[model samples]
Target chain A: MEQEMVLKNENSLSSSLKQMLLKLTPSIKKDGIIKSLKNTGITLLSILMFIGLWQMGSKALYNKEADYRIEKALTERGEEAAAAERACIESGDSSCQPNTLPSPSQVWASLQSLIADHNLIGAKKNAFAKKMAATNEKMIAEGKDPIVYTGRASFVDIVLTSIKTVFAGFLLAMFIAVPIGIIIGLSPSLRSAFNWFIQIFKPVSPVVWYLLVFMIVKTLYIGDSSDNAFVISFISVGLCAMWATLVNTAMGVASVDKDYINVAKVLKLGTFQKVFKVILPSSLPLIFTGLRITLSVAWMVLIAIELLAQSQGLGLFVWEEFQNGANDSNSKIIVAMFVIGIIGFLLDRLMLAVQNMVSFNKNEMA
Target chain B: MAYLELNNIYKTYGEGENSTEVLSNINLTMEEGEFVAIVGFTGSGKTTLVNLINGLLQPTSGEVLFKGVPVTDTSHERGVIFQNYSLLPWLTVGQNIYMAVKEAFPKESKKVLMERVKEYVGMVNLSPAINKRPKELSGGMRQRVAVARALAMNPEMIIMDEPLGALDALTRGNLQDEILNIWSQDKRTALLITNDVDEGIYMADRIIPLKPGPNATLGPEFKINIERPRDKTAMNDNPEYKKTRNAIIEYLMDIGDERKTVSDVEYKLPELTPKSFVA
Candidate 1:
C-alpha cells in the first residue's frame, strides 16, 4: 500500500506537469507564432551573413585600392614615397582612406555622425526659434510675414521633407490616375484612345518628366519668390509614377467578370451603383496592386526629381554628400541608401496590408 | 398575356461572314405562377436564351415582352441565380444577399433588409456561413449563397441558369428542394435552364428541350404529371415519372444522334491512294 501510494503521487505530479506545459503552449495560435519565430530566426541569420560579406568585401576593396596607390607611388617616385603611403594607410589617416565602398561599421558610424550634426543644427534652430517666437507671434497678429529660420536643413528635416513630397506626389498620382482610369475603364473607346498615350508616357524617363514639370512650373512661378521646387518635384514624381496605376486600373475595370455584370444588370443597378458597388469592389485587388506599384515608383522617382529640382530633401542630402566627397561622405551616402531602401520596403508593406484588407482572395498576392 | 414572353427571338454573335447564329426562333411564354424548365446539352445557347429573357442580352431579331410591353433592359422583377454563382468574392454571404435585397428595395430600412437577408439565408440553410466570404465557402455553399441572394430580392419571377450544375449530386438535390420549397410558397413564375432531364422533370411543371447548336432551337415540350412534394426515392416506383423521364431522354438522344451525323457529314474523307501510281 505504501509503494502504490508513492507511485500514485509521482504519476499525479507528472500529469500535472504535462498539463502545465500544454497550457504554456500557444494552443490554437501555436502555428502562427512558431512560423513567425522561424521566419525571424532565418531573417536574423541572413542579415548577419550579409554584414559579414559586406565587411569582407569592404576590407578586400580597401586593401586592393591601397596596394594600387602604393604601387603607383613606388613606380612614379621611389621606395621612400611607397613606404610613406603605406604608413599613412596603416595609421588609418583620413586622407588615405579608400573612397570606393563603405563598410557596415563605417556606415553605422556615419549615421551617428549625421545624427550628431543634426542635433547641433537642431539646437541652433531651436535657439533661433525661441529668439523669434515673440516677434513671430506679433507678426502673426499683425497679419504679416514672420521671421523664419533660414539656416541649413538638418538630416532629419531633409528626410521629413522627402517623405512629405513623396506623399504629396502619391496623392497627386492617385487623383489623376484613378479618375482617368475609371473613365477609360468605363468606356472601351476611351481605353483604346488612351492606350497609345499611356504606352508612350509609361516609358518616359523621370529626368524628362522633371524637365517637363520644371518648364511648366518655372513659367507659372516666373516672378514669384515662394519656394516652388517642392511643387515641381512632386508634380514630376506624380507624372513619372502615374502610368502603372492608370494601366492597371483600366485593365482591372475592363476585365471584371461578365457574370457579375449580369448580376448588376438583373438587379437594375444604376451606372453609379454598378461601378461603385459591383465594379470597384470586384477590381479592388488589382487596383490596389496598381496603387502599390505607383507608390513605389513615385518613391523611386521622387529622389531624382528632388535632386534635379534642388529641393531640401534626402535626395539633395545624398547629392550634396556626393559632391562633398569628404572622408565620411561615401558612408553618409550609403546610410542614405539604406534609409531609402527601408522606407521603400515599409511603404510597400503598408500597401500590401491595405490591399489584403480590401481584397477577398488572401495569400495569393504575397 | 403571359407574365414573361420571348417572342420570335433570334440571336447571332459577330457580324457579316464571321457571325455565328446562337439561337433561332425561340418563342417561349411563361405564365404567372408557373414553373418551366429548358433542358439542353451544354453549349447549346441555353444561357443565351436565359440572358435574352432576363434582359441581359437583347434578342437579335425579336422583342422580349413582359406584361404586354417590350422588355428593353433588366429589372428587379426577375431575379437571376447565375450558373457560375457570381457571388462577389469580396463580400460575405450575408453581404452578397444584402446587396441584392438593398438594390431591389431601395426604400426599405436597413433593419428590414438585414432581417430579410437573414430569413433568405436561413431558408437556404446557409445561416452558419452567413459571415464567410465566397472563397472561404465550398462550391455548394457558394451556390446556396447565390440562391439566397436571388430569393431574398423577392422578385416577381426567378430565373436560374444551371445554378446547381457545378455542385455534386447530393448538394444539387438539396438545393433543388430548397428552391422548390421557396417557389411553392409564392408560386412565382420561374424559368430554370438546365442540362439534367430528371432534375427538370422533378422541379418544373413543363420541360422543353433546346436542340444542339450552331443554330439551336426549342424542341417539343414534355409536361410533368408528378404530384407536389414528390419523393426522390419513390420517384423510381412512379409510373408517370418513368414515362416522362424516358420520353425526354429518347428525344434528347435522337437530337444528339442528329448532331453527330450532321458534324460527320462535314468531315472530309482523306485520300490514301498513292500519288505516283506505283502500287
Candidate 2:
C-alpha cells in the first residue's frame, strides 16, 4: 500500500516534469546556479579572511607603537608620566594617537565621512548657483562673462576628472599613434628612420613629460585660462603612454600576413582599399593588443601627470589627503587606493571585451 | 601570337658562389582555350613557375607575355588560385567571393554583386557555409571558397597552383570534377601545377613534367589524346587511357631515377672488424 502511494506521487511529478522538459539533457541551469553560488561563497570567505588578517596587522602595529611611546615616556619623565601617557592613549586622545596602518573599520568610516562631505559640498554648490543665477543672467544680457562658482571638488568629482583626463589622453594617443604607425609600417625607410626615435622616447618618464608639456602650455596660454592644468596633464599622459600603441601598431601592420598581401595584389586592389581591407583586417588582433597596452599605460601615466601638473583628479585627492595628515587622512588614502585598483581592473576587462569583439582571432583570453 | 608565352624564363636566388639557379630556361606557349598541367616532384620549383606566369615574381632573365603584351604585374585578366586557400579569415565565404567580385566588376549594383557571390558559392556547394568564416570551415571548404573566388573574377586565364593539394583523396577527386566541369563550360585557358601524376592526366590537355631541380626545367610535353567529358571508370579500361598513363608514369619514373642516380654517390663502407677486447 505504501509502495503504491509512492508510485502515485512519482507518476504525478513525472507527468508535470515531462511537459516542462522535453529534451534529454540534464538540468544545466541548476548546475550553473550552484556553481556560481559556490564561487560567490568562496569569494566572500576570502575577502573576510583578508579583512581579519588586516585587522590583526593594524592592531599589532598600533600596540607596538603605543608601547614604544609609553617606554619613551618612562625613560624621559619617569613612572608618573608613563602612566599618564597610557591613560591618554587608552582614552582615545587624538593628540596621543599611535600613528600606524588604519584598520578596515577606519577605512569604512572614512568612506562614509567622504560621502557626507560630498553631500555637504553638493548643497553648498546648489546654494551658490542659486545666489549667482540672477547676477549671471544679468551679466549674460549685458555681454559680460557670467559669474562662475569656484569650489573645492568632492572625492567623486575628482575621480570623474581623472577618468575624463585618461579618456582624452587615450584618444590623443590613438589618433597620433595609429596614423603615424601605419605610415611607418607601410614604408621600410620610414620605419628605419623612426626606429631610433621610438626607442629613445618610448621609455620616457611621466614627470619629464609633464614638465615638457608645462613648458609648452605655459607659453601657449598667455592668460589664466584655468584649462592649462588639465591640458598639460592630458598632453603629458598622451606623450608618456602613446609609445606602446605606436610600436605595437607599427609591428602589427608590418607583420600582416604575406599571403594576404599576395591576395591583395592578385585582386588588383588600389592602395587605399588594400590597406583598409586586407592589411588592417589581418593585423587587427595585434593592433588591439597594442591598444589595450596603450590604455593601461595612459591610465598609469594620468595619475602621475595629474599630481605633477596640479590637475584636479584622484592623484590630487591622494596627494592632498597625504599632506593634510589628519586623523582619518591615511584611511581616506587607503579607500582611494582600493578605488583606483578596482577601476583599473574594470578598465582592463572593458578593453578585453572590446578586443574579443573586434579581433576575430578568438580564443579564450590569455 | 600565342595567348600566353614564357620566353626562356630563369629564376635565380642569391649572388656569386651562393647563387642557385631555380628555374632554368623555362619556355612554353599556350593558345586560347587550352588546359595545361605542369607535373613535378613536391619540392620542384612548380610554384616559382606559376608565380612567373601570373606576374607575382619576375623571371630573373626572361619574360612572360600574355596576348602579345609583357606581363608586368597582376591583373584581373589572370586570376590565380593559390595552393594555400588564402581566404581572409575575417570574411565569411560569401564575403570572400563578394570582395573579388566587387573588385572585378566595380560598377555593378550591390544586388547584382551579391547574386554573383551567392551563385558561385552555391556552385561550390557551400551555400550552407556562405555565412561562415574561413576558420569555422574545414580545409576542403576553405579551398572551395578560394576556387569560387578565382572563378568569380572571370579571368581569361585561370592559374591553379596545386589548389587541391591539401585535401583528402575524396575531396580532391570531387574538386577535380567540379573544376573540369567549369573549364568545359567556358574552355577558359587554365594552367594547373601539381605533383600528382593522375591529377595531371585527368585534368590537362597536355601533361608536362618538371624535372626535379637544382635547375628545374620543363621536360617534353605529353599531349593527352584522351577525349573529355571523359568518364573516369570507363577511361580506366580504355586502351588509349592505359597507353597514355603508362607512358607518362614511365617518363616520370625515368626522370626520378636519373635524379636519384645523379645525387646518390657510392661511399666505401669501413670494414667493421670488431676491435679485440685486449686492445
Candidate 3:
C-alpha cells in the first residue's frame, strides 16, 4: 500500500509540473536565469575582493590613528616627568617646569580651530580678485611711471595665476610640438637635420629655460605687462617638454612595419590615404605613449618653471605654502603636498585609462 | 612576346671591390595561366628571382618584364605570399582578405565586396577563423589566411615564395593539395619558389631548377605533362614524374657541391674603393 501510494504521489507531482509548464508558456527560461545569476554572483565576489584588498592596503600604508597613539605615549611620559620635577622643585631642582609634547586631542583641536577660522572659500576668491586688480593697477601705474607694491597678494591669488600661466604654456607647447614632431618623424631628411637640435634641447632643464625666457621677456617688454611673464613661463615649459612628443611621433612613424607600407603600395593607396589610414593607425600606440609621457613631463616642468619664474600655478601654490610654513603655519605645506600628490595620481590614472582604450590589445595596460 | 619575361637578368649586391653577383644571366618566359615551379638548393637565389618578378627588388642589370614592360616596384597585378605567412597581426582573417578585395575592386558595392571576401575565405576552409587575428591562429591557419588574402584580390598571377615551407609534412601536403585545387579552378599564372622537388613535380606544369650561387641562374625547365588531379600516392609511379624529380634533385645536389668550395678561388677587387677613400 505504501509503495502504491508513493507511485501515485510521483505521478501526481509529474502531472502537476507539466500543468504548471503549460500554464506559464512565455515565462523566463530557467537556464538563462541561472546563467545571469551566476554572472551577477561572480561580479559581486570580484568587487568584494577588490574592496577588501584595497582596505587592507590602505590600512597598511596609512596610519590614521597614529597621532593619538604617539600623543598618549608622550603624555604618559610627560606626566611621569612632571610629577618627578614637582617633587624635585619642592627640594630645589632645576628643569622643574612641566614640558610635554602636545596631546593628540590638542593637535586635533588646533586643526579644527584653524579650519574654522580659515574662511577658505572667501579668502581664495578675495585673493584672486586682488591679484587681478593688482595686475591691472600695476599695468596702469607702469604707463610712464613705476608701480609700487602696496601689500603682498595672498597664497590663493599666487596659485591661481600660476595655474593660468602653466595651462597657457602647455597649450602653446602642445600646438607647436605635435605637428613639428609628426613632420620630423615622417620625413627622413627633416629628421636628420633636426636630430641634432632635438638631442641638444630635449634634456635642458625647465629652470634654465625659465631664466633665459625671463631675461628675454624683460629685455623685450619695458612695461609691467603680465603678458610678458605669462609668455616667459609658456616658453620655458614648451622648450623643456616639446621633445617628448616630437621624438615619439618620429619614432612611431619610422617604426611602422614595412609590410603595411607594401600593402599600401599594392592597394595603390595615395600618400594622404596611406598616412591617415596605415601609418597613423599603426603608429598610434607609440605616439600615444609619447604624448602621455610628454603631458606628464610638461605638467611637472610647468610647475618647476612657474616656481623659478615666479609665475602662477600649483608650483607657485606650493612655493607660497612653503613660505607660509616658514613664516608661521607649518601643516599647510603638508596639506598642499598631499593634494598635489593626489591630483598627479588621478592625472596619471586618467592617461593610463585612455591608453588602454586606444590600444589594439584590450588586455594591455600601456 | 610571352605574357611576362625576364631577359638576361642580373642582381648584384654592393659595388666595385665588394661586389657580389646574386643572379646572373637569368632568362625566363611565362605564358598566360602557366604554373611554374622553381626549385633550388638553399641560397640558390630562388627568393631573389621571385622578388624581382614581384617587383620587390630590381635586377642590378637586365630586365624583368610584365607582358612587355619592365617590372618596377610593387604592383597588385602580381600577388605574393611569403614563407613566414606575413599577415598583419592586428587585423582579423577577414580584414586581411578584405583589404586586398577592397583594393582589387574599389568600385564594387560593399555588399558584393563582402560576399567575395566570404567566398574566398571559405575557399581556404577558414570561414571559422574569419574574425580571429593572425596571432591567435596556427601557422597553417595563418598561411590559409595569407592565401585567402592573395587569392581574394583575383590577381592575374600569384607568386609564392616557399609559402608552405614552414609547415610540418602533413600540413604541407594538405596545403599543397589545397593550393593545387585552387590553381586548377582558376588557373591563375602561378610561380612557386620551392626547395621541395616532389612539391614542384606535383603542382607545376613546368619545373625549373635554380642553380646555387655566388650567382644563381635557371638551369633548364622540365615540362610535366601529367594529367590533371594527379594523385600524390600514385605520382611516384609515373615515369615522367620520377624522371623530372630526379633531374631537379641531381641539379640541386651539384649546385650545393659547387657552392661548398666557391670561396676558395675568389681573388678580384676593383679600384673604386681606393678612389672613394682618397676623395
Q: DockQ of every model listed?
A: 0.75, 0.74, 0.29
lDDT of each: 0.89, 0.90, 0.75
Stretches of model 3 off by over 4 angstroms after superposition: A1-175, A211-235, A309-312, A326-330, A361-366, B264-279
Give the alpha carbon lDDT tens digit for every residue of B1-279 in model 2: 999999998999889999999999999999899999999998889988998888899988988999999989999999999999999988899888999999999999999999999999989899999999999999998999999999999999999999999999999999999999988999999999998988888899998999988899999999988888888788889888788889888998999999999999999998898879996
* Docking quality band of candidate 1, CAPRI definitions: medium
What tier of docking accuracy does candidate 2 attain? medium
Worst 10 residues of 2 chain A by lDDT: A19-28
Error of 3 at A283 (Å): 2.5
- Give the poorly placed runs of model 2, Cα more than 4 Å off: A1-45, A130-143, B265-279
Residue pairs in collision within model 2: none
Who is ahead in lDDT, 2 or 3?
Answer: 2
lDDT computed for candidate 3? 0.75
Q: How would the candidate models be sorted by TM-score, starting from the highest? A: 2, 1, 3
- Per-residue CA lDDT of model 3 for A1-366, tens digit only, reads 433443354455577666466346423444555689999999999978865775565444333333343445457777666455445545534233122222333334544644554456456656766767867677778784434443444444454565566456656766887778778878899999998988887877778888888888888887765556567887887777677777888898878888777667766667887787688777777777776776677677877777776665667666776666432233444444544566556666776777777766555543
Clashing pairs in 3: A161-A312, A162-A312, A162-A313, A163-A312, A163-A313, A185-A250
Listed per prediction, chain B TM-scores read: 0.95, 0.94, 0.91
Tens-digit lDDT track of model 1 for A1-366: 433443354455577765455446534335655788999999999999999999999989988999999999999999999999999989999988767789999999999998999999999989999999999999999999998899988888999999999999999998999889988998999999988998888999999999998999999999899999999999999989988889888889999999888888887788999999999988888889999999999999888889999999989889999999999999999999999999999999999999998887776887
